[model samples]
Target: MENKKEINRRKFIKVLGAGATVSTAALYGCAPGNHSSSTDNPALGEVPIDKMTYRVNPTTGDRVSILGYGCMRWPLQAAPDGKGEVIDQDAVNELVDYAIAHGVNYFDTSPVYVQGFSERATGIALKRHPRDKFFIATKMSNFQNYTRENSIEMYRQSFKDLQVDYLDYYLLHSVGGGSGIKTFHERYIDNGVLDFLLKEREAGRIRNLGWSFHGAVDVFDYLLALDVKWDFVQIQLNYVDWKHASGNNVNADYLYGELAKRDIPAVIMEPLLGGRLSRLNDHLVGRLKQRRPENSVASWAFRFAGSYPGVLTVLSGMTYMEHLQDNIRTYSPLQPLTDEEKDFLEETAQLMLKYPTIPCNDCKYCMPCPYGLDIPAILLHYNRCVNEGNVPKSRQDENYQRARRAFLVGYDRSVPRLRQASHCTGCNQCNPHCPQGIDIPKDLHRIDQFVEQLKQDTL
Candidate 1:
């Protein structure tokens, strides 16, 4: 396996070492241009500065761009000391420059994204531009140590890092994770942090206050029933997850319906289903291509999310110029999906349910595995092979040699040796953080066993 072929097996997967979204473009099998430097990629020029769709917030009357920027997966590079990774500030500036120029004004970040580097980098990039050029959003990500002091500190620090006097949008970040309502109360209500945020909103410091939901429907309804008037709410909405929500997540149809019922503007997330929809199986890809030959498979999801009148903006965590360019093209003067097209995507979603891919969104909430395993990379690589039809079942399979080598070699190439699935220690620290409610340890163990089996069958 120590050959040139093995080393370069996944050369096209990683972009600027953004383990976050590197494989997002793997289906195209084309290595991206240098997005690390300030150098321009002509594709960036194609992003329309005027054609972007805009939606109004009924409460504030703020006209937000429909194509919002999710700052969770910023471009990354190896740090100077080579000990760990760091956000690529120059790349972020370029990405921000093109996004603002292309009429993208809604930028969302969180205290938890990019290992707490997202807000700082986003602030640095946007600082050069006029403050009115963008509407910045961040979260009260008091997932742990949600004591009143800690949670309040986390909230205040966001202002400092974002370099903003007032946050345009502030969230109660990814509620309903552990113990559902119990966790919600402890994280926000019991600690008085929710009251503090609500007060800030009244003082004009937080223009819009909302929460991003990721768990039980009861919690979603519970939050909606609260006396507080939510300005906007974020939920994972894509064609596949609209009706057939997996894991602890609520279906997008229900989530959106409830938000619309309350007349609340919605901020959409996970339009790509963690890149699974884009890297669909060959037959599915062909089906989509047959319908819209010029459109990217990923565009269908964006169209689905943006088609709804209730959606204020659809967020895409773009890490490269091409991803940004492709999204801008899709949303430029937005084309709402017709009834027939919506039905087609629903059928496509039903077909996608059959594939056995793990639902890791690469949110990296379950990151910094104590034992050094790269959880998202391991799961995503497995997902890619599954989509590509490269995960062979047994040695007797006709494509055994090709598939086996593809799995083994691609796994090694995409994930560093120390960070491979074999390193997972089943410590279970990553379980509660997973918004999809994946049994991280069990899945890692199963994947490790599969890899070991593949290695032993040398035939």
Candidate 2:
């Protein structure tokens, strides 16, 4: 006898596989039985599915969907054996079908995404459709094994796993982040991997070649300065990173500007700053909502990313049907931001810097903590409290008593006592895994001290 929660989880997975419109409508609070039309709910009026905006790759003449699908965060459910987690393949297939029918033609995945199963799952889903209908983008992702043989083997494995004869787009995964310029050179330049990839492109096995950047401006400049013509480049671009990049000194504005100057098509990632831009403070939310009352907060980020002339595509990791629908509507007929609107968002970014919130995207890459701390939940609760005005600055503030009570109550309710931040031992094992470059141990320690002070009412 399964519990109600377990039964509902299974039911949801089934619903996702049955049909796209029905599943998405049900997920968004519409009646499940009435699968006739989406217009039943005024909220989901009618997405211009056939009117999706597109941009062309100047080098290859590929008309890519501006809203490219990122296959990193697929929906997950407990395996039938109830032993471990597994991607819900049926749901993935339905989502892929729905996306393609609605005008999306690009999908991005990597060897290491989704516990190393993303590429295979993506291939399985996309293979059911016409091969010429959608473009496949994947990466070498051999960040560790720099040996030429290992690199070549990894590259070949991607094609086999993807079930594709030739990749439409390929990237050097996470360039410039870990070991800086020297490691980058040792991985690609010294090892002859770059030369091999260039040859693959020349041979038509790889249609386009580029790299996804993370840190170290010198490395970015170094790659761009090469004689090799890069067909496209991916960078983290959002209103927040445009001006206030968290850990990296380089900003998206500079990155985009550099690419634009070089006539290189820029592929945008982290347009929502790993969901931070979507979940904004009440004050900022009010500011945005007041203008576009019908739009979601996430749509603003998408529009901003698409406004650039150099952008070839903006990648979003949509795990749920509702996310897919919302993004589809946003990009169907993208409303480019006006200069005034851009200024307003820039001002909002400046104001957001005043409050210190950890830039954790809840990606869950760093999980199963050795110390049993729920890192994402801790950071989420803290950020939520900050957004809702439940974080009191001092004990003397007028709302300190109420805010303190709310924060403490919410923190405990959100995260179990055994998995709270106070249990962190500063192991620092999670630091290297975070894509956002967050200082995990330092943040956990600081948060633990803050929680202790809240308990003692000393701060």
Candidate 3:
């Protein structure tokens, strides 16, 4: 039998080391032109900056990339592109090739991403390369189709789709996806699903056993306290949510601190707060630029998440090549933020709090709104308008015009019309579903009233 301890230790060493280098190289631009400290021979010293940072897992001392390639946002084709009728395979291949060549070894994906095409796309893209060149991580997405058979099928399909007999990291997806964890355990784990997974691990099918969480601290603690040793756990960690928990209306600081106490390696999701932190206000952006003018705004978010010690990897949904390259540079030779920089970000966080900005990370946790309202999408547009100080113009000119076009023009192509925030009856069904504890209906009313005023003014 293979030694579980040794397997985990080896994995940690590999992941942590690979990740550390990536982080360090990314700090300076790939081409050491402007940011190079010494002015020796410019031509001789022209070296491309590495695009990943590595962290050492204390348990096994494996080096992992600071920047993990997230497959959830892979480019998709309209139709007739690949097997699943989605996901541009050629683009995926290019991105994966670039990422791997640049030192990003960890590729994070799930069964549900891109309507289930992500895993297949990942497998197809990576199959040509040496298996050892990269590490693959996927999850047990037993939430939506919550059935024993369905769950089992999904788990089984992940390996097949990933084209890997063994997974470097396997996670119980979204442990905080409602009382779904209990359902998962009862349906799968308690009924020997965990046993099956563990058996596979014993057979070297799963290199690591952990979960990505999005719920209460109690739930997080429950999973962490399990007698079976977990190799790593993924969490939504970003500047905005640093002070907030996933769904429990609690601060994330407590949750992360608990993990730190237990010595669990934390894989971070949404380090950029679903790309919100990347595009910050002018004041904060200016401050960040002052600290590191060469680095992109997104680098600060990644650096802030990496500034903490317990973090194993910070994952980003890099859809474009430029985004991927920028991130790689950020993580390569990872530059941990100084205390002064951290303080500045904290101050910016407070300033952001002053604006009645909805704390939605747009994780789409409360997706498929019963009333046909694009809750997250609307919130995003609203936030953008507010941030840009064009709420009146946005509501009247943008959303209203779009709605009019949708209703008047081709309804099939456009987003289906239903209740705008103005039409919200305040049924308040979405309130509890939100992890951010936002007053959903109340805010909808406020926005709706403002939009109404705008319409009336033009009338």
Candidate 4:
């Protein structure tokens, strides 16, 4: 009979199918469980400028930083007119300046991020630095308008918005979504967009070309099986998703294995599972704290992604000064995970799986809902209540009254009355854009119904 370690490893292999690449003893480290006990957080300290870890791009030999800056959630401020919000230029510049000063050189952005202002905000911030000092990566992001003309114009607009003559890295953003191959072909091949991009690569306008995956395993396999020489690819990776992926996502073990086998460098996204890992429950936080009290809850996830030799970079959307500082400290000479530590994280993932939480990364892809419902805020609040154990099952439970009060109070504080889940009209407009494959209208309605039940005094 096998020991617990061997048994767990075999079980993981059987479930994931391509278990050769992932291991209970090795993958990314992430805290799992509740966040209320996450108070034992590591203190921030000095980040070394010359100590940043670098990865070599085999195709172009570009030396990219192990920690890449993801420009998806830039800091925002109320617009002068107070009608809405806009990216905070000063805040962005400070973050960029500090990141570069600490040796981070790779910055990734797309046309769809930050309500279509990410490219412009990122451009404004990065323009302060010398061209040779950093690498710029952006995407076509033409999900709605995939016509050849519209796609090419979208691609060109990136150059104008970013104020760059050429892009260091370019991608067919959010591929492999929904209809899988059909959507991929219609978005790139059928519209001649891929052909145009290849020609752009030939003209030296795009230094490296790749795509991000978010759907079926067949779609990923089909893309890799193609004749095109992919420079690098981005995928959602973290401890939880390594073998036990939620929703419609494929396991990361298979995704990473295929890329490693082809020697295709991988750019990791959602390393924290949309910030799920960092904000683990109290019990889970205690487990990680017992082993390494000095490391932040978020560091485990970052080290896991950077530990893989085949990974070119790990992206983090740093919106605050402390987050940027903490991430820099984690990657400024990364300390790879040990076999024991990796096994511990695998166990954490299993325990976390037992607790059902919605897979919302707060990427804000489902923003500006036609019905005025705040999608991410609602889902994130629901997940937080789940992690904190505030969602009551029955009025007869011991703490039912307390739990109900907390949920209702927190819900109102976290989301406005008019923009709460109750406001979701089930328009289905925000469904396709979600990378996590969440059933937006369905989940929203479910949450709304739950709130209504909680309001009732009936047992």
Candidate 5:
């Protein structure tokens, strides 16, 4: 009987039409200087930066940007004092000014983001403009100290850090993970933090209240089941997660449907799946490019996130000017995917599953492995090699020699020998820290074995 890997590889080959090849240039439209198409053909370089789509919040009637700014991954710079990395306030200011001017009116931040400096830097940028011009959304991220006093101080500190009297949207950070319902209760319910925030809402200090979910479906259902009005819920949503939610266990289809049923708006996070969708395999990129010749690979994911009527805003962490510009182009006059296009995307998702690449997004949360393994780099190199068709299957295959050489050479170059997966001792120290729920030691061991097999020309 064929094993799972064999079956998946067969499916992958079937999807790609046996040994068909797609050029990187064709997948990415064309080279920068090569514009040989007809005059009537639309230029791919023309991005509508000024045209942004807005979604009105049903509860507060705020016209939030469909492309909401996620301030978690702000641009960093060497601090003037030379202590360490710090948020680049000037870059933040420029990006914020450009986004707001381009019609992005909603900004999401948290107390825990950017080493707790995100709120202050974001405040510095947004405060320069009129307070009423943009909606500021932040979170009560007191995960360690769940006591009432600590939680309250954290909440008040957000107001001070953000330079806002009232919050437009507020969240219970990372509610449905780790200890699950027990952690949720201890962090919010038992400690009276949720009740306090509820009263704050009534007092008009918090305009909207919600929670961002991570683990345990029951905890998510329980929070939603509460009779209290939830203005919105922030969720990790994207094409891949809609059906196959990766490490989250729960699919976005169910989450979004439940929220829609309750009339609760959804604020989307990870719409690009931490940049995974944007950096797809050449074949997948070719498939999308064939359908929409002008749109970006990332734009398809953003449009999919925003197509749903229940979504209030789709948050993107724009760390660079180009990312911000590209995202703005995607949302400006958002085009909802048609039924046929949706079906096509579903097909693409299935084809992607056949490739069997590790779903690591290079989040680096599982870093500094106890054994000194560069966990993210190892996984990233493996995933990249797999995506680029450099994963050798057998010595008999036509591309086996080439694939093996590329994979081995690239792996060595990408990850230092000292920090390679071969060094992992399987202590399991990094497993719990991973948001994607990857079994770190086990995966590293598998990768190391694969590397050894490739070296022996037996894979």
Candidate 6:
């Protein structure tokens, strides 16, 4: 019988070997289900003087920068003609250039970001550089249009839009049961989507196949079991989410362990818990400051996720230069969080669960609200207002107005005016769909009333 050490050695060898012909089952180690600094991965590259740390994929021996550039929220400016259409080309190009110059190379985007323009914008910006300069990751998001034909066409269109023949990394978008995963396979896999993708892979159009998960651990495993040979999996992993009431994204410990067992790598998302961790409460901030006075609160969260062994990269949706710079500094030469610091963060995580705030991570899952509710966006604005100490009448009025405009304007433009929040009619269809269990009709009515009052005041 092979001993534990020999078994692990063999697994590591297979990990660096050519794809899929090996026993993926041998990839898991016998150590406790947690992270450990093992052998020095020779293929791993160090972040430049400008960067901090580097993470390696156990399977492919690829060294991805610890901080990945997430193009989901690119900076926007008004068009040259100032027609109110925001021009993002220059900002996107600069950000992409800065990231690459700093030795950061993993770029993640999706077809649905920025009203379906993020992919095009990212493709154009990155195309300015050599293809080998970065790994392009995007998703097949055809859930709302759930048909097999729609899914395949969307995948084909993604390649055309990104100006790349093959995706370095491709995900099945979100991994929930309802409209997310169910619709994904219905439109993709069950409809022979995997067969088509495999043919593309054989032709080298897809370098890696992966999925980003949301609800249902079983569904995540089920997707992995499908013989499709997933190269990696992305999960919403952060110190706060480990024990989040929504689901222990802390379950990520198990999820990552399982993936490692399967020789699959993990890409982490929501490291700042959709920016909440960046705007922590004063007491928690003080505690973190006392421990590491120089690091941003967001840095602690990002490090906590990167401290793990199997994570291939951490994604941050940086919307501004300062945000990008701060993240670059954090990952440039990261100091792993101490055990006491991890405990403190876990304590902070528990404290975080005390608030009445909704658990929307801005994953855009609750989007396309049938009632024209800009659900995640509105909730995020509200949460940001409250977190930033601008919730009082003296400070919150302007922010409140902005939120009102965003919701009312988005409702008018995206959702039909008649189907606006004012017309919710208390049907309760959206209540159960909300992962956060928030009373949808109740909040919509409150927002409608507030917007009406704001309009009256402006009048």
* The best candidate in terms of TM-score: 1
- Writing each residue's lDDT as its tens digit, candidate 4 over 72-161 gives 878776666654456788999999999999999999999877656789989998999999889999998876666899898989999999
Residues 102-130, model 1: lDDT tens digits? 99999999977776678999999999999
Q: Please provide, for model 6 over 204-265, each residue's C-alpha lDDT reduced to its tens digit, 9 standing for 90 to 100.
A: 88888888876666677777777677889998888867656363233666677788788788
As a whole number from 0 to 100, the lDDT of residue 21 in candidate 6 is 16
Q: What shift in Å separates residue 205 of candidate 3 from its native position after superposition? A: 0.6
Tens-place lDDT per residue, model 5, 1-459, is 235533543443343321111111211212122222121122245457567888888988998889899997788765555544566789999999999888899999988676467899899999999999999999988755678998999999999988889999999987886778888889999989999999999999999999988776898899998888999999888888889877755799999999999999999998877666776777898898898877778888889999999999999988778778878877778989998888888888888888877777554446445455668777767766666777877777788877787777777666669878889888786776576777778888999999999877543
Q: What is the Cα-based lDDT of residue 89 in candidate 1?
A: 93
Candidate 5, run of 10 with poorest lDDT: 18-27
lDDT of 3 by residue, 368-413 (tens): 3455455655565455444433343444465555443322222111
Q: Which ranges in model 2 have alpha carbons more than 4 Å from their true place?
A: 1-43, 363-372, 398-402, 412-419, 432-435, 456-459
Ranking of models by TM-score: 1, 4, 2, 5, 3, 6
| Cα-lDDT of candidate 3 | 0.66
TM-score of 1: 0.91
Where does the lowest 10-residue lDDT sum fall in candidate 1? 34-43
Runs in model 1 deviating more than 4 A are 1-46
Instruction: Tell me the tens digit of each residue's lDDT in model 2 across 1-459.
Output: 235533543453343321211112112111112222221111254767699999989998999999999998887766676645578899999999999999999999998676567899999999999899999999988755688998999899999889999999999988886778888888898999999999999999999999998877998999999899999999999998998887743799999999999999999999987676776776787787898878787888889999998999999998878778888998888889999989988998998888788887665556546666768778867776676677888977888987887777777766678878888988786776576788888888887888888899744
Tell me the deviation in Å of residue 112 in model 4. Answer: 0.9
lDDT for 52 (candidate 5) = 83
Candidate 6 Cα deviation (angstroms), residue 228: 2.9
Candidate 4: give the clashing pairs.
28-304, 29-300, 33-281, 34-280, 34-281, 35-280, 35-281
Give each model a TM-score. 0.91, 0.86, 0.78, 0.90, 0.84, 0.76
Could you tell me which 10 consecutive residues in candidate 2 have the lowest summed lDDT?
A: 21-30
